[model samples]
Each structure stands twice: as C-alpha cells, then as structure tokens.
Target: MPSTKIGILETGGPPRELAERFGDYAAMMRRMLGEGYAYATYDVADALPATPEEQDAYIVTGSPAGVYEDHAWIEQLIGWLRQAKGRAKLVGICFGHQVMAEAFGGRVAQSDKGWGIGLHRYQLHERTEWMDHAAAIAIPVSHQDQIVELPPFSRIVGGSDFCRVGILAYEDQPAISFQCHPEFEPAFAKALIEARRDRLPDPDAAIASLDQPDDRERVAGWIRRFLDGLAAERS
Candidate 1:
C-alpha cells in the first residue's frame, strides 16, 4: 500500500486562542488517525475546494454553524460532495453528520429534545465489515442538531433515545458519518462542555458527566477500519 492522503474539511473551529493552545479538530483527527495518513485541511467554512479531485478522502469536522444556515460555503461544500459522489470515501462528525444528512435529502434541525453534551452511548443496531465490535459504545458528543429523516438508500447503523440517526451509511455511497466525536480527547471534550456550560440546560450535570469513561479509542478504531476498508475497496 502506498501513502494515503486525507483531506480535512474544516467547517468550524473553537475560539481562536483556545484552538492555538489545544489545536483544532483537524489536528485532533491527525493525532488519532496516526502517521500512516497524510492530512491537508481546507477551511471550507472560509473557502471551498477548488476541485472535487483535490483530496483522495475527506473528513468533515463538526461546526458551530447549523446545517440549515443560509451560508454560501455550506452550499458549496454540499455541491462539492455531490460532485465527488461515490468517487471518494467521506466521513462526517457531528455537524458534518447533520450536513451530510440534509444534503442527501434527509432533514436536520435543532432537536426539540435539546442539547447533548458529554459522554453519550449509542447502540449499534447494524453491523458492517468496517466495524470490529458492536452492541453499545460511549463517545463524546456536543451537538444540538439531529438527523430526523432517512435519505434515499440510507441504512441506520446505530442510535439511541436522544439521537435516532446517530450513525448512518448510504447504501450507494462510500460514506459513513457519526453524530459523536471520536477525535475529541477527554480534555477537549471537557473544555467544550465547560465553555458551553452556561448555555447548557444542566451545567453541573454536564460537567459531572464528563468524568464518565468513554469508548473514544474504540470508536476511533472503527473509523480507522472503515476508512482503510474503503481505501482497499477503491484500490
């Protein structure tokens, strides 16, 4: 196997100063994905990729911007996604997940159930070759939007009470998306939870929940296998 280069489509970032200290989502992804993969980040929130062929694979990061927002960049990103279609393996996290859902004819909105912060457990309902384990896995989550409908040719892989479309794969597309953040370290999850503490419905509870153990590494392994498998299939 030759070297693999993956593109990080950065939709948003933490506070500039905090991002400097802790690094951004792209950096976190690189750290988790290890050295076998080379990464290039396109601040798609700021600028869209010049061409769909620029990146071999793409990982869309979480964002503060809602998928339903009237943003040109968001539209551009979706257009790029449509262009790439089945040509590349795409993975989305949090906001990325929501946007992908919406772009694929599904719907995404601010959940009436409210915000989900800290560790969340999603039960794996369907198994694919990309996953090594199943049942239930706890992962760091920080999102208010939820995927409410299934797109054409979509299959649900995992879910829970809070988020029905927790994990999904398109039958005709080379893509998998997660509603949780496997790239998030405990400290980063804690920091994000704390930063939004005042806005959260239960600050104390959310803070306390951060201490709970998570399956971050396990989820990371799943993502790694999924992408690697996609690459192999393509090759």
Candidate 2:
C-alpha cells in the first residue's frame, strides 16, 4: 500500500530552540500517525498549493503572528481553505484555527482577559461522532489570542472558561480547529514559556507549574486520542 501524504501548513514563528529540541511539527505528526503516513509542510503565509489533489490529509500549525496581520499570503490561504473545505480533511491548530475561523466569516482578536497558559481543562458540551470518545480532557494551552465568534454552521466540540471556542468543527465538513496547541509536549511548552518569560505576568509561577510530569502525560493522552479519532473518521 502507498503511504498517506498529509500536507502541513506551518506559519513559521516557532522559537528556534523549541523547534530544534522537539523537531518540526510535521515530524511530531508523523510519529503520531505511525508508519504509512508522510507529511509535507508549506508556509501558507508565504505560499499555498494551487490544489489539495495530492494529499490524503492537511493540517495547519500554530504561529506567533495573528490572523488579522496585514499579510498578502494570509488572504490567499483563506481562499484556499474555502475552496478545499469539504473535499479534504483539515485540522487547524492555534493560529491555523483562528485563521480558519476568520477565513470562514468568523472573528479573531487578542483577549484583554490575558493569556491562557499551562495545562487547562475543557469540557465537551455535547457528544459528537467525532469527539464522543473523549468528552472531557485537560489539554495544554498557551495562546494570547482566541476566536471570539465562530463561522456559519460551526459546532463547539470542547471549551474552557478562558476560551469558549476551544475546538470547533465545520458543519458537515471533515475539518476541525483547536484553540490549544496539542502538538506541544511539556518540555517544549516550558521551553516556550522560558523563551517568552519576560512578557509573561508570572513567569516563575508558570515554569514551576509546568514542572509536573503527570499533567504532561495526561495532556499527551488527550491529544493521542483526539488524533486517533480523526484518523478513524477518515478511515
């Protein structure tokens, strides 16, 4: 059997240390999907493919930049997503999720409520065939911006008090968006926190909180199950 080729649209703002230590997001995804799966990354903010014809799946990764930033390629990416909505399976994480929402007639803005960092709990409001298997899970979160409003026909799959639109699914389409960064491990998250420590309100507290191993494992389990669900749905 041929390998499944997944397309990854990386927004390219990852810290150099974190990227070097954890490897690229595509590498982590390849590990998650096991063998018989491969991924290719594209800088959607720079260029996106003319079509999704060659890929089995597509994922949009997180970025430090906001979706509303004045970038020419960002508009093109939104257009690409609109065109490929139902034809392909799309998973948007962090900035990708925000961009997808904005692209699909939703709104994204920086929260005056401050950042949602460290491990957080999210509850699933209603059971769906896609996320019913894992209703409530504690996932890692570290975002300053969020999707304030959802696009047409989007359903809330999961959420916390800080983020009402944690996980969203497009109506009848095999597309999913996440406000948290499920791709991050504890080490990677801590690395990021340390790198951006000066900007945080309480950097010491945040680092101390992330020192626990159990929380990291729990979050990892949640992500594994979530990704498993996606793969099952596609199959």
Q: Flag regions of model 2 displaced more than 4 Å.
A: 212-235
- The residue-by-residue lDDT of candidate 1 on 176-217, one tens digit each, is 899988888878778777787778877667667768887888
lDDT of 1 at 14: 84
Clashing pairs in model 2, backbone N/Cα/C closer than 3 A: none
Candidate 2 C-alpha error for residue 149, in Å:
1.1
lDDT of each structure? 0.84, 0.74
TM-score for each of the candidates: 0.94, 0.87
Residue 138 local lDDT, model 1: 86
Candidate of highest TM-score: 1
For model 1, the superposed segments whose C-alpha errors exceed 4 Å read: 230-235
For model 2, residues 1-235, the per-residue Cα lDDT tens digits are 6666678887765677777778877665555455555668787766787787767668888878888888777878888988888777788888889998987889999998788887677787865554435557666778899898889889888898889899897786778788876667767777888898888868667666665543334333444444444332322
